[model samples]
Target: MFSYTGGVVLFAAVLHASWNAMLHGNRDRFLSMTWMSIAIGVVSACVVLYLPLPPKAAWPYIVASGLVHIVYNVSLVRSYRRGDLAQAYPIARGSSPMLVTLGAAIFAHEAIGPLHALGIALISGGIMALALQGGRVSRAGALAALTTGVTIAIYTVIDGIGVRLSDGEALTYTAWMFMFYWLMPVIFVAKRGAPALWSPLTETPMAVGSSLAGGLVSIAAYGIVIWAMQAGAMGAVSALRETSVVFAALIGRVFLQEPVSAKRWLACVVVAAGAVCLGL
Candidate 1:
């Protein structure tokens, strides 16, 4: 079980990074994101038919998280518009752990130690460094990515609380959240009249397949992490999952032809170190 947990965590990390890469590589990020959300909605629709609803106690958190996810998705798209994947991905991914830690301390009365403080400082410093890269990362990109991270931290806390109140049916809660989370993007696209919305899926088999793959991978990544948390050490699982920062950087450089400087590599190391500290 431990070995399986580790493998699952690794695969989840890769999938998480891959989906982000897909979003980054897409020519029309907003459209791609809309399709991805619709894909999630389609899958969730099937699951919610048989799964029990989330407990009433979890509804508020689920709703709040759904709303925050919309902000996250929008910010992510905007960040990718103005920044290279290598730069934006690390800053966004790196920022979340410290913010989540601080949020826990404030909202859940969690204790903070020297290590936690150090981790927060390191993450903040690394993100600041990325933001201050002068011509490398645009201000719009930095702000958008940082905003994405903040939204991620908020939804993560909400999900953590809501899942506990799920009456041993965390999957059901997740399904419902996915369903609700997709609605905003779908509505937005509808309002603007997306004439080419279904063209990619209907006219191009590869597009359909890629969209399905992205959605499945996205769901699988989160689902696997949740399973790993149940079967293994949560801290270890979390730290391992954050290795996606490294993976994202490599993917951007190798696949997307994005320029990753030595300084950015060092920044990634600092970010990963901070994540490790948070886990510890």
Candidate 2:
């Protein structure tokens, strides 16, 4: 189970980075995100229908996860609109493992070794260094991204607990959580305006294609991580999956034409090394 979970975590890290890159490629972040949400909803709903229901105890966490994910998506979209993905994605994702580690300590009474603490510090420092590049970090954008990180940590812990409570139906819970997660965007559209809702439908084919890719990769990334947690320690799974930062930095440099100084590249290496330490 540990070996299988490790493989899943590695695969999830790649897919997670791919979807983030797709999101970064879009010009209209909100519209692209809406389409991605719809795609995820459809896929998750199909999975939910085919799989058995999760145990009753898992529903509370599932619902809480849905609410937390809504905040994460909103903050992530806003952060991307305000900052470059290289800056935002690393800070956003990098903060999560540490937050999850702290949450585990408080809620689950889980203790971390000195090595894990060192890894967390390295990861956090690397992200901060990356975010501080260009001599001007948008505080609002950074805060929004950091908030997204916190929400992700919340949901990660919640879902981790949910999977444990589930009677061998982690996949089913994951599918349903995603199915209900669509409600956030749906409610946002309904409250904001119909124009915001309908605009994505008229987007160009290329934009729609990118959105679809983002949606598919997002599902694959998260689905694999959730499955992995069922078979391994949640902290290790979370830490390993966050290796997405390395890919995100590379994508930003290559595709977004963002300036990647030698300093940032070194920071990225530090983050990757930290993730390896956490995994070990």
Candidate 3:
């Protein structure tokens, strides 16, 4: 079950990195994010209207997931601004699966065997290696990225339970979850006032297209991962999907002109190997 789901999640990871690279390629990060959020909002709203409401019990998790997603968006945008996509992307994504593993062990009583622990350690080390550039590591950037990872893990676990509680309405839960997730960007734009927000929109079509792509990818990646968790282990599903870090590294090297040292490549290999182990 996990092997099949992991394959789909791997494709999701590729899409995930592709859209992020698209966002990073844009000049106006804020505008790109705004457009992406709007696209996500529109799609999610359409899906929500067509689907049934989630069960009452799923509401709390869905709401909490939305709030966490807001934090993730804010942190991700900030992190991207602070450093190279190669640096930020790996750190932010690589840290989450381990946290999810820990959370599952403690909260859900999911047991982690010795091999899984080693796999988690390798993934963490690889992420760290990728984040460090020229022997200079940004502790703040790492923390911010880790915070994003933690929040993702929180929602992963929440949604894992949510899908089960939704009486098998995974689609309904996901649609509404994204609908609520879009609210944070709207609130952020409102808080920033109109001028600061609208300036980015007028800038370029590349920016708009990038944001739309990002929004669509976000919807697809997460929706598939959530569904995978419904059909497999939450921890394994999160870990396997995050192998997108490897893809992110490749995108960074080729497109962003970020340095990918031999050591970092080795780390990427280790992370990929760990993911394969977890899938097995």
Candidate 4:
């Protein structure tokens, strides 16, 4: 299961990067993200109908996760708006694992070994380096990306507990989480002229297709991470999952035409080393 978990999460990293890249490229990120949420909502609602409902004890965590997800989505949109994909993606993805590791050790009572501690340090330092290396990012963008990372850690810890409490039924917990969580964004967009807000998603074929693709991939990536948490330490799972930053940097450089300096490449290598240490 350990090896399988690593493989699954690495695959998820690809999907996570792919969807984020798509979101970063969208001219109207709000509309793109909104439509993506709507698509995921539709799919998750269907999945929830067949899966067993999460236990009552898990409800609070689920609700908490949903609220944190709202902050994460908002921060992510703002981060992308203010910064390039390579800059924002690493800062956001890199910051979460260490936070999750410390949170797990403190709240979850998960013990961290010397190697794990080293891994967390390397990962966090490397990610922050990517963000702070050059004056390539705006102050607002850097703040947003950092905020996004903190939110990711918050929700990850919440969902880790929520899934464990759901009678080992991670899928059911995830389906319900997605079903309810997306409502936050939908409500936000609807308030700003509902018709106008939704037109890009509803009226344009290309936008609709991208939303569907991004939504499905995003759901699959996170769903796999939630599942992996069931069989691994939340911190380790999170660190492994965050290898997405490497893929995101590559995607940004190749597809998005973002600059990828030697410093950025070195940072990605450091993140990989950290992930390997966590797995050890």
Candidate 5:
């Protein structure tokens, strides 16, 4: 329905899935994610210099969203460690819209319509299919993926509300949040020191470049999302962005050489369908 914003967010979805594939494929997930965050923060620092600060109303939500994002990263790394990208990626992304739906109904006392129910059903079915795959998804991985979904839902709500409160300064809010989130990673790098952080820079220059590229892609992906949320309904925008689940499954199969079964592919499609339903 939202053609212009839809095209932008679908592009974001592809970029999101691509970077996530890189994260899942990396041997040192935590370090790679941290490096990506550092790169994003560095770039954001420069970007934010020219843009005016987001209005005061958005600051608290920005900080809260940043903190929750840290939790999302930690859970995501753990999920990848414990499961296949095909399994973990779908589970993580698929559950987000459902949770966002449920949270609104429960916490915000919003009534669930037929479309929301249908979307939840589809997402739950997809997740169930993923979980039912014998020896594919670990218990810890499922839990971690669910945790990641929770964080996504929380931050989606926060950002949706926060950006609207920014008085049309969505880019400003996004830059500030990206910069603020890396504060933890900065401390992590400090404690680990230069040798640890710079080791990949010298040993594997390509990995360094990949992480940097992923960071830029990540910034662009989420920046679009933040901006799109300002123009669209929060739930729909979040759901549309989560179409990444399908792209991730394909990337996991092709790029990572992971053995993706037909059923798994179907499940991913179902999850994406659910997300689309939520958007519609």
Candidate 6:
């Protein structure tokens, strides 16, 4: 069994995968991404009002994280545009734990035990396998996913540091970060023009509705992750949280009808094994 924090993060991983897999249902990946961002931002804004502000020490990180998250979302939309959810999502997400581990070590000064190292190595190899899946996901998708992974690593460390420095205001910090980070539909509105962005709302109300649900799930998932980070090493929390890749592989295969090769299944197993090692 996982430790308390590990269990919490594991639950978060499930939620994370659920929402991401749902993301494939939309016709426009950009629209889905934008709508989900808006939905999460709206919810976060409401919650952030009641929550106390994070300490000044955490504000810089909050701002920096917000900037980075924008990049992450944009890259994610691009990756999905060019790839299968299983291939792109795993490559995007599975690569993050190792990056976070390295970032946490250098920036947070966290020590890596042998088990942790082994776990990261396994996860990294699994990600490589997923990325190498032939002709299923485009080169552009892989590149975009790699970019997303980098942003994920950067923000994971930033948020880990931010939330831990919140003086027990982890909830407040997380809420504020999400609220500030997204401001949701604003960027898309600017890009597509307000008319273009909102007009789709009427046509694809289902996508909008599902995206809203996903937004709620996304916030809840990351909220748990930020809370868990307070009690675990940033690297460990990140590694464990990334077990979403396994769930993602399944969701992509079953619901979305994305092909999952035996090789991909083996890779998912390897990733899960790595996650277990990280938990241990």
**lDDT (0 to 1) per candidate:** 0.71, 0.80, 0.78, 0.84, 0.79, 0.82
- Give the lDDT of residue 189 in candidate 6: 78
TM-score quality measure for candidate 4 = 0.95
TM per candidate = 0.83, 0.92, 0.92, 0.95, 0.90, 0.95
What is the per-residue lDDT of model 2 for residues 1-280, given as tens digits with 9 covering 90 to 100?
2365666777798889888888878987877777788889989988888888888999999999888887788788888987888888877887888788778778766777887777677877787788777766687988888888888899998888788788878778888888865775676678677777666567587787788778988988998888777755566677778877877787877888878889888998887777767766
RMSD of 3: 1.9
The sequence of per-residue lDDT tens digits that candidate 3 reaches over residues 1-280 is: 2466768988988988888887777776666777788888899989888888899998998988878887777777777886788877877877787778778778677777777676667777677677775655577777777777777788888888777788888889888888876675676668687666666656665667678878898899888887877767677777777778889889988998978888888889888877767755
Residue 217 miss distance in model 5 (angstroms): 0.8
Clashing pairs in 4: none
Which scores greater on lDDT, model 5 or model 6? 6
Task: Residues 150-201, candidate 4: write the lDDT tens digits.
Answer: 9999999999878899999998898888876567466665667777665755
| Candidate 2, residue 136: lDDT | 65
Off-target runs (Cα >4 Å) in candidate 1 are 1-10, 116-134, 202-205, 225-241, 275-280
lDDT value for model 6? 0.82
Worst 10 residues of 1 by lDDT: 229-238
lDDT of 3 at 176: 88
CA lDDT for candidate 5: 0.79
Per-residue alpha-carbon lDDT of candidate 1 for residues 169-226, written as tens digits (9 for 90 to 100)? 8688788888875674566567666666766766765655665677777877876665
* CA error at residue 206 for candidate 1, angstroms: 2.8
Q: Candidate 2: where is the Cα deviation over 4 Å?
A: 1-4
Model 4 poorest 10 in a row by lDDT:
180-189
* Candidate 2 minimal-lDDT segment of 10 residues: 1-10
Write the residue-wise lDDT of candidate 5 on 126-153 in tens digits. Answer: 8557545667566788899888888989
